[model samples]
Target chain A: MPLPPSPPRLSIGAVAGKTVPRLADLPWLIGYAAAFAAAHQAAAGWGGQGFYSLLYPAAGVRLALLWSRGPRLTLAVMATELIVQTIAGIIVPGQAGWLTAANGVARPALTYGIVVWLVRHVAARSQSSLGVAPMPLGLAAVTAPVAATMAALPWTLFSPELTGVSGLRQTVASLTGFVVGDLLGVLLIAPPLLWVVHAWQYRPRALHRPTLRQLAGLAEAAVVLGAAIAASTLLAEIGLGVPAAPALLAVAWIGLRFGRTAGWCAIVIVAAIVLPFTATDLPVAERLALHMSLASIVVVGYLAGSFADAQARAQSDLSRRDRMLFQAERLKTLRAMSVAVIHEISQPLSTLAIEAKHLHEITVAADPDIAQTAALIDRKAAALSTLVRRLRRFGGRSVDEPSALPLSALVETVTALTRAEARAARVVVEVSPIDPDLVVFGQEIELAQAVVNLVRNAVQACDGRVALSAHQNDDRVVVMVANRCPDRREARPGMGVGALVARAIVEAHGGTVERVTHADGTICATLSLPRPGAET
Target chain B: MTLPANQPDRAAVYVVDDDHDLGAAVARLLCRHGHAAEPFLDPVMLLSVYAEAPALCIVTDIMMGDLDGFGFADRVRMIDPAVAIVFMTAWPTTANAVDSVRRYGGLDYLEKPLDETRLLSAVDEGVAWSRRQRSIRARTAALSARERQVFDLLVQGHSNKAVADILGLSPKTVEDHRAAIVAKTGTNGLAQLIALAR
Candidate 1:
């Protein structure tokens, strides 16, 4: 039986190709044909044409293909089924004729085509990616009965004479066999096949490599699968009541603990051990009872796996976001502290340079020893100043360190750093006195680099003056940088890389940078960042 | 260290800076170069004692806690117009250099870790310029009020008759006053008188 389409979340692990089969699709089709012939040969002894077997894994192959490759391949699917059956000698035109062969082809084709279409329809309405997530048991339960009825319809209506049923009661009994076989096939076969398709398509790179814990979980589930198989087979052979009980309990545990992939594997393993018993000579009621018990196990296993997959995905997403936020925060704090410290030391450094030079001049003529010492001081101070200047240059740093940085200190440091540049450009820089307590959370060095770039650009962009100021509005701090461009023709259409860099930095901190050019020749750039403790 | 003997004609120079150690060091360097140099930590303190005994030149820091170097120069200019001002700053730029000369009447603007050669040369030139200015002012100060008016007109290339008409005096009296202006100011001719005024 074909598995019901689950939500796209679990199914998205595979690359779903919507186009019809090309040369690339031949391998999967050939593989499916081989599985179909093998399954047919295995169930040949069960009843008439092996159609009454407890599990139809071929139904799963059809569903998996239709789910991933889309419904356009239904014709190709019917053709392949006819070819496989003809080669296996199940369809001999000389004996049952072509009509029976046509009915046989039409049965699974119509049944599984509707099954895939219905699954895609439900997945579409829920806005899910097709075949990405594991098939949920709820969708399976809904599609299984429809698949059973559809699979049985072609045989009941077109080939009743071939079925050897004379009346309504016998016909209904024959129909029940087809329904139970197809239903049991879908429940048992489709989920594991979908998972195999997912794993194969996403192998090596696209699929997330399983971590150690996940591998360990799979190993644990494997052990439980082994125990369940051994116990179920021993119990059934001894004619013990509730032979599937241990297997059902083990499947539920695997589904909830190891997620859908492992859960489906366990279910398939358990089904393989128990399903062949239907071929043995037994009472019809007892065979039906065994099929029902296996069906219940399939449903329980899928439901638990679906729940586990959803929980794991939600947890992984939350932690990843948290890690990014922490890194950004740490980066901003360290940057701010370093910038402020550099600005403070710059004045004393200038004094050191002057004093050292003076000392050298005073001692040079009279005392050779003192003169050499003074020269050393002068040289070291000059080297230190060069290092400081290089450090003060705008260079991008790691964005992981962060802290709450005062807006007042940030603006002051940047203004001081750019003072000589502004003077060289013949522009006067006016910083509006900011409230000392106003602070924003971000990487300090990056924010300073952004502000410095803006100020230097403003100086170069304007005629005479650049004004920088900041103010608090609720939980946000907005820093405004405006420059006077007396000649409107000189105003640039864009602030270029400076504004782009600032925008990227501010936006990273969940803020915005807005720039406006006025007709009066004043260009204003405003940076709005979330104040400390105000970010949601 | 023993004090070097002071030159009798040493130029009186003042160094004003916010950094006390830097200011003192610059002053000592200036003194070693044979100038009666003194250091002032604050521009305000420098200004308070400036009027009593004015220096020939002043070297001041541009970025200061109280009055900036420009403001200080302006005040000093009001007290003694001949005092040469040289501006210095930790941060130097083309705009500051232009403003130092054009707006603040500075002889030069220098950046710190001071070049001793440039500082000494600037101070020497400023002292010579200040001396010339003082000499001219003293010679011009000797003229009587009436002769001073006549001298001003003559310096403008006005004829003796035109000077008399503008001053509302007779041509004989105006010519007599011009001679008195030349005698009192020690100017040999109209060209010398005009050169002195400039």
Candidate 2:
């Protein structure tokens, strides 16, 4: 799975993992209920027989709450709605009975449970990605008609004037109105609300000030979408009817160019511009045509924005893989060059020592002063030789035949080579005793270089101690380098150049390198190689 | 006065290196210390004429152009099992050190710009080791199959009765074989035979 576009943040209440309402949650619940009831009352004016609302904005609030804030918040909001509505049925004049009020709360509750299950098990499971656009749009498309029919049936069945064969046409009209109204309401209102709630959930501590390019892009999107809305409304005014293709094209351009937030904003802007014209006592068929046109705009914007986001993510992944391959090639060339240089230098160093020793041997009795000078020269040459040998341990590229090397010996050599660096860093390198007979088939020097790189990285990163150990697990020998951090939150997440080189060498030997960060702050890198008989 | 590598009793020692100067200096140091030593610039060139005059000991560099020091030691051992070999390299590693003794039949692995005291001591031990191995092979060449079996068991600390039981022979027959083993190998007693076997 790919990483999410932005890191998700959770509210303190949600982070508390509370499944029941608390005293601290009272203010939030009351505010949510107020918003829900206001939208419900606005739809009630054209609500046919107080059931088939022409535009049900309250459906948007219910779905948004369930999707973003989880069940506890949604449930609390619904409980408050039920109490307020039941009291209003008693207090307000010309209000429906308590059953009607109760149905309002019960309908949203049922839809919330079904949408949650479908989003979790169906939408999220199918794609393995629940990005802002695709997941909510898919859920809305599936649940709208079903929820609308469920809410429309009770009113159609209970009314006395619309009974038996006389009521059949009215029943069909009511169902059609409810489905169109509910689908339009959800398609328009739910996505923008979901976007707002998601932005709030993952909001940073400091408000993000948009860059100059972002501000300029937003201005450009506003200008294009505004022209689209103005041209569509003008055409409707002049009796040409509302042509939706031009406006939809503008919204799709904004979505594909400016990303999800700007695209969804463009859809909302276009819908807000079209809503008033549809409300001017127009014919019902014309109004439904306008609503269907706006729904198409929303769907197009959602899909275009999703494809753009996926393309951006794939480009980033390809770039990172390219960088790792480049680093591995560079490291290989450097090792070969260093081995050549060291080999050339060492021969002269050998000649110098031999000459100094020969000088001391020929002049010891005749002149003590000359003999002492020769001894000092020989000592300096020896020091230079020691330095060259130490350099070879790290940079020597082996071209020798591969053999079955004992794991114990390999571990010992790696630890010994890295001991100086560990001591300088004030880190302890602990090696567990490996099995004497367990062996891996590879060139010893190269494998040591691979392991030494891992151990050296651990020593540098560790707070105190780095543990080095190896064991035979079935057919492979697993060598582990682990560092336990003092604080889990401080663990670094990615590999460095040395680690990439280690991975390249290990992989060439029919092995794998896997890194894992444990919950308790232990970061372990494991190198597993095939045993002698299981050689690749 | 010792001429260059012509003393009969001194035995020959050959030093092989790709670097002509280093190989010549090493051979010169060994000659000055009263041993018959000669230098060869290429390990491949040395291997061609090695069987014509097998040296008592060989000192070879590992990272040469053609055949490496370890490969050269393996070939030399095939030709003359009694000749001792010592490895020298500029880039020394634990793997190289372990392999010199364990895999290549090398007496020691030394790093170059070689320490004077350590190099001399290693060469001295290599020569003595070669002579001892040659003497042992010659001594054991005369033993019959039955006497060789008794010698093997006796060196492993088995008594005459144990050897007799293992070979399915009587104690008197085992005792006779052990006496023949000691006489053929020209050793003093059981202790001498055990030391020679080692």
Candidate 3:
């Protein structure tokens, strides 16, 4: 009989034409068909067609194909099944050609089609990517009986030997036998097939070659698997109550120890070796009991794989948070550093802005002093670039050896450097005659930084006058910078960085600097040091 | 070391900053704008000339050593109480600066790198403000002893009754003194008269 009008037909030929590379797809299709034929031929070799015992791998492969290839591959399944059964010559012994095809190919393929649809409905929410993760057990458990019952209709119709079992009781019994057999086949074969296909699809690259430790772990797992199977068989033969103990322990050990890949590998190895052994001469209840034992092991493997996935995710998440925190801390430090740098550089930038504005003013003035304005810009620019250079060489200054220097010349030189600033501010610059006999031993450049910081601050702090004086008393040379205080209300010193930096430099050079506020509110900063060959 | 007593004294800018070059540059810009400007590296110099009221507009920098811009301005208020002030700072003005400007009656608070147009505009407004203040001070100076007393007490936030109680006069007499104070100062209302007193 013809199939009742089916829903949307999904053909592998149509799918392959569109999605797959034709060149690659041709080889894959041929291989799928060969594997499909080979599983059937193997089953028949184990037992004749009349006695449909356990181990029907063709059903498992059919379900796998239906899932991985999608419903579009329905025609591929029917066509492949029809050809394989005809070649086996056991589809029907003396029936019409169409009758044989329907009974052999259409019957099993349609029943499996219904099973695939039922499993898809039940496992739709928890869908797996077929080979990559374990197929939901509910898919096979719910699909088995429906498939077995559907198979009985066309099955008894085509086979003349079972024509007497068309009664409802006979059909139900046949359905039961088919369910037990198909369920065993699917449980035993489907998981291992998916594991192999998944492994092949995602084979590791050459760059990720396993380490010796990983190889030793794999070897250890192999020894454990072999021992488990051997122990279970021995236990079953002796009629001990705990035949599944070894299987359950090995499943948990491999699953938890090495994660999903190793867990699936352990499951496949156990299924391949132990499944066929349980198929011989066993009563229905005993056979069913053995299938249940294997089913429980597969579920344990699934549980262990899930635990491994969760831990791996959590570990990666923790590392990501740590990386983000480190980056945030680095950014905060950079922001603080930039604020300090801006503070230092702002004086020069402000000077530039002022000078540029003044240049325009000078051009418009009657008898404008162009030369004076140009000189001012050039001087300010020089000061700015010098500051930049010093910043760049902050930690890398060449160590200079100290030598004796003329104290009078040093004072005169430092005063000359500050004269332009004093002239612009209209501040009086008074230098008491330096003592010709007073000299100190030190690095001139290092001492210059100390002197300039103090002198500049004095000029900035005085009203109309700043004075520089050098004197010698009792083997000690002293340089004094004095400024008339701006405010007489307790002469509060301005909080500029130059004073602090000057203090640090003077202290570092084995010299002492002092600040004093006179009763009249005139401020004095003095630097004193031991003259060469004289004690402090 | 002194300019003629009559030379642009009423249209002058006093540019005080700790950075001597910056002070000179600012003063030079004001001179180009036709205002006689004196550059002071130290804010203390303002104290010396503040009693003389030499500059109408004082453009100063904050963060000066010895005396900060606010301290200098406050002292300026003591000597020449009506000078217009413009503060230039390298850092962004904080909330404290806003409060200082409001409390001290400063004309403007500016940040550096100084925009030339904004600086020129602020100084021009400050010059105008200082002129207005000088005229108001002159008018207030013309008030009689009784009117001055009433104005001072009223501007100090004392009511007419409170001022009468303090000075042992009737509230009606205090109100008459207040009216005379407002008219002499050329103020439209008590608030304007009080601002003039300030």
Candidate 4:
């Protein structure tokens, strides 16, 4: 399965957590809220309920993406939510003391727990599906719901007059509302928030954009926000009551189009503009209480959003570290294999030196067949030169960049390059029939290096005979390097040099590798890679 | 084969290096100067043929695989201790230089890529030194112990008093030993005495 997309930058905040002092966090939160409020006001009045709802879910997913931190960060977010809510209540003062001050604080704290729990659940499911360990899934699930429920308590208690209806009616309505809001928030806001966190952390080139793309995306978001506000205003003027649903739809649409921050900004703007109109119909105390409660909800949502973002970022970082560790281990194995290659090649070089000296002596004693001996010397020298070049290339020197290379040409080059070394070692190399037109995408030097490594390994593995072959089947080009196993006692552990380097090269080109050991004590390493211009 | 003393042939020099082009070029330069020179790419082959030959001088590289210049020079010195040795190396180190002088008695070290002028000059100096050593051996063969000591001091540019002090003798006695050295070599004056020492 393809790997999940990386999280975005805002999500990384979950990992940094309180590492960023409250003094710094507070201003950013305030700015985010103000932007959110303005966007909400503009979009909800201009756009319909569908747009607002769409915006909320999108914003919620974005926030969820950002919540990368573990339980500790969730708590911090809860605190931030409470603080922001309290401040907004104080500033608006449109509700009763108990409803506005106490209820406002309680609602956000509860929301924080629910959001954290749901995020942990989703992240667990994702990990299990990906076949990796699910990190702290159960912990998040249990703690999140409980924390969110507890945080919501003060709201129910402070506003008992309005919400404390007879029987189970009030309880059911409250529970339903809480579940729907939290679920919507987690699903819609969390994913985008996580994406942002991942993007910021890893900063993959594919996700990067030029200034023009960024500007275009931003401009589109502004237009969407304006439409949301117009819709919200029209709905309210027609005595359709407070257009909360329409305003939410507008937020969702913006979220989908422009991401979380934009969606949340639209939500806040709609709230600011609509809340004042709704407040005018109520008594001073009720108005104050209502205004404060709404503001508190906004603040709570922001904190929860940020907390989710940070957690996602932390998880991504952990995965990235794991990948790096795996790569390092692979490199170490390659280095160990190179030692064997050195041993195999050094013997040939020593023998060649001895033979050259003998040839020189014989030539001086009797100049008979001088031209033939001279040609032989030149040929041997050229072979030794090629061997040295291969060794140097394997030693990690900067070589020519990868380019489009034909499979047949690459095999021919490697065979020619290693012929002298193989001959000195008393091994024979045979090539299998292959398609001349079959081309593989990669640098010729790298492909040659891979082929050379494989041929050398095969020769070393076999007693005296090895075969190098290639074929094309469907979209994949298959190259097989086979050697008769040296006695069973000599069969080294793990993958041999040829198989390892060949596998590395093939995989780097988005291919698969396999090894087969025949019943007759012969080993074959096959590299299957996608042909150039073939759909993978 | 030993050459007759009356012959007018100039002494020959040999150069050995893995680089055939450079070695051949050097040989041509020596030939141009009226000296016979042979270049070899393999030091082992060069050593097997030239070990006993009385060459005026030899030039070789220090980094060859089978027999490096120093090893070849050691073999040459074993065969004939009087032949002059000049070493050429791509990488010159202090230890190798000192070792070359100590082990093979090489006259000088040259770094490659060699300048033609420098190589020729070094070859000339080495040949001249070898010729001087040959003449000294021929002249010193018949000197008595006392005369040999005085002759050595005179070649060192010492005065009569310094020679007497070194030999633990009076100035008159050292003068008598110097007179005997001049008579034994059959030279006329101090300049001729020094030339005879050479």
Top lDDT model? 2
DockQ-based ranking: 2, 3, 1, 4
Which has the greatest TM-score?
2
Per-residue lDDT of model 2, residues A353-392, tens digit only = 7787688667777678888887788778878877887777
In model 4, what lDDT does residue A496 have?
Answer: 48
Report every candidate's CA lDDT: 0.73, 0.74, 0.67, 0.59
Worst 10 residues of 4 chain A by lDDT: A46-55
Instruction: Give candidate 1 misplaced runs (Cα > 4 Å).
Output: A1-20, A30-52, A67-75, A82-240, A306-310, A365-372, A396-536, B1-198
Candidate 1 lands at a TM-score of 0.52
lDDT of 4 by residue, B1-198 (tens): 233334568668887878676677567656655567888889778767874567888888787788778778878877767788888765444567777888778877764434445666777788888887777677677898888888888888999999999989999998888887777777777888877655
Fnat values, candidates in order:
0.17, 0.54, 0.46, 0.00
Q: Model 2, which residues run further than 4 Å from truth? A: A1-35, A42-55, A69-116, A119-209, A276-287, A328-384, A395-536, B1-11, B18-22, B28-35, B41-48, B62-68, B89-96, B111-120, B131-198
lDDT value, residue A536 of candidate 1: 58
- Per-residue lDDT of model 3, residues B79-179, tens digit only: 88768889887654344357458976777787665666778888888888888778876998888888888888888999999999999999999988888
- Report chain A TM-scores, every model: 0.57, 0.60, 0.47, 0.36
Interface RMSD (Å), each candidate?
8.1, 3.0, 10.6, 13.0
